[model samples]
Target: MITGKNYIGSQLKAAGTKIYKTINPQLNIENPWSFIEATPEEINEAVALANDAFKIYKNYPAQKKADFLNAIAEEILALGDELLEVYCSESGYPKGRAEGERGRTIFQLRTFANMLTEGSWLEATIDTSIPDRLPLPKDDLRKMLVPLGPVVVFGSSNFPFAFSTAGGDTASALAAGCPVIVKSHSMHIGTGEMVASAVIKAAKKNNIPEGVFSNLIGSGVTLGTSLVKHPLVKAVGFTGSINGGRALFDLASQRPEPIPVFAEMGSINPVVILPDALEKNSKKWAAAYAGSITLGTGQFCTNPGLLLGIKGEKLNQFIDQLAEEIEKIAPSCMLHPSIKADFNNGKEKIQSQNGVSTVAEYKGEIAPNYAPQTILTVDGKTFLENPALSHEVFGPFSIIVQCKNNEELLTIINKLDGQLTGTIIAEPMELSNYNAVVDALQNRVGRLIFNGVPTGVEVCASMIHGGPYPASSDSRFTAVGIHAVKRWVRPFSYQNWPDELLPSALQNKNPLNITRTVNDIITNKPI
Candidate 1:
């Protein structure tokens, strides 16, 4: 059922001569399907279609949009075993992981759908006219969040389901009334094709406008650059490497009409283990982190790649225990050969650095594309001196840093590049003494964890899945959760406009019956 073609406004087309196929990393062989790269013409047409669709689709009632989203979830679930099989063949992930990610993806879609039905996400506000004011009359002003036109979403390499076609970026954008054009990740083009079909089917069943959703296939930068630089694209959502995300961010910034790019990039999520905690529960903490480090082959952005602890008997014992536990677990296959190569390159780079030593590494020979879990150790002085030590290795690899004192630990935390998460392992009440360390970590990460690993990110209204600088292009906006819809919208105000002419959410009649702020008071009442 995979067409291996571009989805331009619900129609499948393959006019380009260039073609590529996805690799089955588990078997180290190419899949049967061949995908055509999107040409410049196709990209332009898709963008234009999205622009046209946005004019009509942006004004759709919340219920209709919610129906569309919910339908997508249903259609994806209908994909059933075929989807799971293709996902495993293309990405080398096990069936269980595919199912789990599929569940997460469906949950995200439904979460957005429910949010739309609830209808308070727009944050509408109104101030009635004050014609009887003592000094001068004030004009009536009504404001609400409105869609920001078409958005370009670049699928992440690691997360084929949750962050790919019909993923968070697409779901949140459509929920916010913005048309979406997704540049499918080449590694999982077949999976992308299947998901796109489901989305298009849902769109048609719901009578959603054409061009409201598109999935383009391309291997490199040409198609993505065209989409990002297109005059119609008002925003972009990306999840990938720092270089790749930064390039898109730069391209969007340099355009004639600049657009916002919410790019979730690299992170070496750091963990700080307090002395008392290490002394009291070194074995327990070590076992937990060993699992966290190798979870999903450590492809997670929230993987604890760096660990900090005071250099002493307790920290040394914890390190030995962690090394022993990690080596016992077998290595797993990476997503692709390129990813495996990158993991090797990153490990080599870290090992080549002065003062870096391997404390533990999987010594057994593994199949092609399988990554070896590794644990490296380095002194705080060496880690602080060399910025390369902080770079994310992007696989089942971690580095434990031995700090000389509390001051040095705090300094190292401050020096770390922005991260998606920072975890602190401490005995009860032990955190009170390391206020400075906690404060420094707080400033550097989007989320701070206490006595826990940062492996799993919960999807909720409160989760902050972004951070400063390289962790994400914009820390103010999160790449996960319901609030992500805010990234695709902008506030618009109608001054002295007639109630009948205003949008339902802002109209004085309160036809939608949703919550709103009227004259600084939260209510659902009509003016």
Candidate 2:
């Protein structure tokens, strides 16, 4: 029966059917044969199938599409133990994270279902005729969002469930009636396969056309590059390293028909500690920064990699306390061996830089594939002169930058690249004079936080996940939250179309009764 974990839908057994393995950094054991990786041919077929499905899936009634998306969510929840087990085994993340991620995945799918069924997300706008124009009579004009064609989604390794197979990108695209072909992350292939199965099952149950959703697995970039370059692809959703994402962006942009690549990439999430804020609560600030920098072994994209503070006794106290706290925390396992090697290399690079001091070097023995949390300090001049220090280390490591004055701090912030989030730890009085800091930070990041940690991302309508340039390939579209759907949709306008022929969202009678702009006025009435 070949029931020992293989590809779904098409029944193609992976080559050797034994590429899956688990890297437990804590124990340093690589367990093999947990699952299999789909071959490149299989990947090609998956995209072709999605392209084939788009012919009918895009035209399916919104209600039916919503049913399919909701059904997929329900089935994923049904996977239950199987899903959690595979998720834990593959990534070494705790069960709590797995369950939370599962809930988030389900919530995302159902949220998209709600958005589709409600039908207002299309943002229909209609302008009735101006019958009494002196020079010319204006006919009715209507506009609404429509699905882009096949969307290529590259799942992120850090977030296997919530940003993976049937994650936000796929959910949003499916809800908008766009077919999705996911390039599964190699780190969590088992989770990807399980989620892919759920999606395929739901598609069949809801009579969704074949190929509405497909999954591909490859450790290398061949399959991903092929899918992105395929003439049929209309958009891409990527969540990974700046280097990887940038490669895909370049490929997509250079295509004959340049498509949108929403790539959420690197971040150093700098936390600025104002002088008064530091003096008032140096110890507390030190502890908070220490925890944030080491959380998840510093694997989180929003981990506070950089800290900027004015040079003074308060800052020195904070640094001393931070070093003490970081060293006390037990070292933990990183995601992979390659990641650990890269982290150590990056740390060495920073240390070798001129004028950089090792505030705290973790001298403990790190288990294979594990990274010991380390904190380094550098003067503001050294930091400003060496832009290479700004690069992401992707492990439990942090750099404290000491500035002589507020102007130096501002210069440092201004010189920094775009980030996912920039935080300010400030006393009320200190914050009052930092309007320029706020403005500069706002320009440099997609989200600005006040007196809070940047580790947790809230999924909501207003959340802005993407930032300029290296933070993400596109800042106009977000990779998380409800607004993520915009990446998979494009606005289409119709002029003087027959009332009966117009889409329901734009018809004169307003059959959907969705909110729309009529004569530049917001209303739910027919034009």
TM-score of each: 0.99, 0.95
Residue lDDT tens for model 2, 1-527: 11224342434456635355656554566645455666656666766777888888888888898899899999898888878977876676778888998998888888888888777788898888887887999888889998888998888878889898999999998888898888878777767888888887888888887777777766547777888888888999999898999999999889999898899999999999888887888888888877888877888989999999999898998899999988988877677677788999999998899999999867888667667888999999988988988888998888999999989999999999999999999988778898998899999999999998898888888888889889999888788777899998889999888889987888888887778888889888776
The CA lDDT at 96 in model 2 is 87
Instruction: Give a tens-digit lDDT track for model 1, residues 241-356.
Output: 99999999999999999999999999999999999999899999999999999999999999999999999999999999999999999999899999999999999999999999
lDDT (C-alpha, whole model) for all candidates: 0.95, 0.83
Clashing pairs in 2: none
Number of clashes recorded per candidate:
0, 0
| Each candidate: RMSD | 0.8, 2.1
What's the distance in Å from true for residue 337, model 2? 1.3
* Candidate with maximal TM-score: 1
lDDT score of residue 25 within candidate 2: 50
RMSD of 1: 0.8
